[model samples]
Target: MTDQLTQVIAQATLKDGMRNSTDSLDAATHSAKKLARKLFEGLDEDKGGVLTRDEFEPYFKNPADAAEAFKVFDKDGNGDIDRKEMRNAVSRIYRERRALATSLKDMSSAVSKLDGVLLGLALLITIFIWLFIFNPKGTTAQLVPMATIILGFSFVFGNAAKNLFESMLFIFSIHPYDVRDLIFIDDSPMFVLEFGLFSTTFQRCDGQVIVAPNSVLFGKKYILNVRRSGPMWEATKVMVSFDTPLDVLHEFRTRLRQFVTDHPREWKGGLDVNIDFMQNQNLIQLSLIPSLVVAMEHKSNWQDWGARWDRRTLLMKEMKRIMDQLNMTYKLPTQPVSFMSGQNKSPKPANSLLGAR
Candidate 1:
C-alpha cells in the first residue's frame, strides 16, 4: 500500500509541473500580442492600417530593438515590414519598465534645477525692491553718502535688468531668418556661433571669433546661402596667363560650363561664364568667371559645406579637370579685384579697355 501511494504522488507532481508550463506559455503569448498591438496601433492612427519606418521608430528604444522588430514583422523576404504584415505579427513580451523609470528620474532632476533658478531670481528682485523703498534721510553730510550709495546700486541694477529683459525678449522673438543667416560677411567667410539680442558672435573657419552688433549685420551687404526658399550662388574666378591663346580660353569656359551641366544634382540650374581682359600692372590679365547656382537647400550641409574635406576635394578635382582641358597656366588669387575700386581709379575713358591700359 505504501509503494502504491508513492507512485500516485509522483504522478500528481508531474501533472502540476505540466500545468504550470502551459500557463507560462499562454502568458508569454498574451504579452507578446499586447506589445505587437501597441506598436501597430501607433502606426495605424496615421494610415488606415500601415506601418512605415518613421511611424515605427518611436516605439523602438535602440537599433537592436528596431532590427528585431523589423525581423519579426517582415513576413515576406523583402527585408522590410509593410502595414499589413506588421499588424499580423506577435509583439514581444518584455516590458520597457526600466526605460520609463529612468525617464521619470531625469524629469525630476530637470524640475529641481528650474526651481532653484526661479528662487534665486525671486530673492534678487526682493532685495532690489527693499533698497528702493527704504531710503535714508539725514544731514547734508550723511545725505550725500546715502545718495551716492543709492546711485551706485541703481546704476548696477539698472544695467543688469536691461540686459536680462533684452535677452528674454530675444529668446521669445526668434524667427525663421535673422542677422545670423550668411556664410560670409564683408567678403570674409566665418562660422556663426550664436545670435544675441544686441550682438552676434562668429568664429572664422580658422578658429577666430568675431563679435558684431545686430545693427552691423543688418546694415552689411553679404552673400547668403539661403536654403530652399532661394537659389545657391557660387562664384569662381580664374586668372590665366596673358600669353594663353584665345582658343585655350574658350575651351576652358566651355569645359567649366559642361562640368556644371553634368552635375545636375550638385549644380541645380544654368551656368554663366564670363571671359574678360584687363591690364594688371604692365601685363595683360585674362579672367575666367564661372558662376554656378546650386539649390542651397539641396546641399546637405549648406552652412558648413565649404569646410568639408570631401566637398573641397570634389571642387578641386573639377577645377583641375577644367585647367587640364584648356592647357592653361593660371593663378588662383586669394582676393578678387573690386569693381568699385577698379572703376573709380581708372586712368582712361570708361568705354575703352585699351585707353585704360
Candidate 2:
C-alpha cells in the first residue's frame, strides 16, 4: 500500500507539470491571437481596407520579424493572410521587431560609408608623409628641397584651405570677415597705404580715410588718368554759341574731332560733341566734351579740356583762321533770347510746331 501511494504521488506531480505546460501554451496562443486581431482591425479601417507594405511593415522591426509574424498568422497553409484569420493568429508575437531591424541595417550602412571616406583620407596622408621621408638623397640635402617643396605647397594649399573653410562657414551662415581692416592715415603726397586680402585702406587726396574692397576696385568702371601711365579722373564741359555759320560750325567740329583723334595718347578715347538748335530762341548750342589725363605733379598746370578758357582759345583760333580763308561773315550770338513771354504767350498747338521744319 505504501508503494502504491508513492506511485500515485509521483503520477500526481507529473500530471500537474503537464497541466502547467499546457496552460502556458494556451495563454501564449491566446495572446498571439488577440494581437493578430488588433493588427487586422488597424489595417482594415474604413479609410482604406487594403493593407500596403508601409502599413504592414511598421508592426514588426524588420523583414525577418515580419516574416515570422506572418508565418504565425497565415495558419491555413495559404501564403496570403485573410483579415479575420490574421486577427485570430499572430499579432502579439511581432511587436515592433521589423522597424528595429530596418533601423539597424540603415545605421550599419551609414557607418560603413563613413569608414570608407576616413580610410581613403588616411591612405593619402600616409603616402604624402612617406614621400617626404624616404627619398634617396642625403638627409641634409633632401631636407632643404623637401622644406622648399613643402613651403611652396603650404602657401598654395593654405590659401585654398582658407577659402574652402570660409565658404563652408558662409554656407552655415557665419561671418568670417570679422576683423576690421586697418585704415592708413597719412598726409603723404603719394597714396601709399596697406592693403588686405579683400580690402584696401587708404587716405584719399582730400585726406579722407577710405576702405574699398578689391572686388570693387577691380570691377568698377574707372576713368584712368593717363598722366604718365596712370589713370586720371577729371572731365570738362564747354557750351559754345550757335549763331556761328553752319560752315564755320562744321569746320570747328571737324577740327576738334581731328585734334582728339590725332592726340590719341592724350585723351581716353575721342571727344564727344553734341549740337542742338533751340527752337523757341532760334539759337543753336554746341557742347564739346573731352577727357584728358594729367600728371599728378602737374595738377596745378593741368587745364581742363572742357574749360571755357580752353574752348575760347580753340574756337577763336579756328574761327579766325577759317574767316581769314573763306572771307565769310560768321558772327557769334551774344546770348539766347526767348520768343515768348511767360504768361503772355498762348499754348502753341501741337501740329503747328511739328510741321514747321
TM-score of each: 0.41, 0.26
Model 2: how large is the Cα RMSD against the reference? Answer: 36.1
Question: What does candidate 1's lDDT look like per residue over 17-64, in tens digits?
Answer: 452366644664454455456656656656655554555556678877
The segments of candidate 1 whose C-alpha lies over 4 angstroms from its true place after superposition are 1-151, 174-204, 207-229, 243-245, 280-301, 306-313, 330-357
| Model 2 lDDT per residue over 278-309, tens place | 53344555555555433112221132222324
**How big is the positional error of residue 245 in model 1, measured in Å on the Cα after superposition?**
4.2
Among these predictions, the greatest TM-score belongs to 1
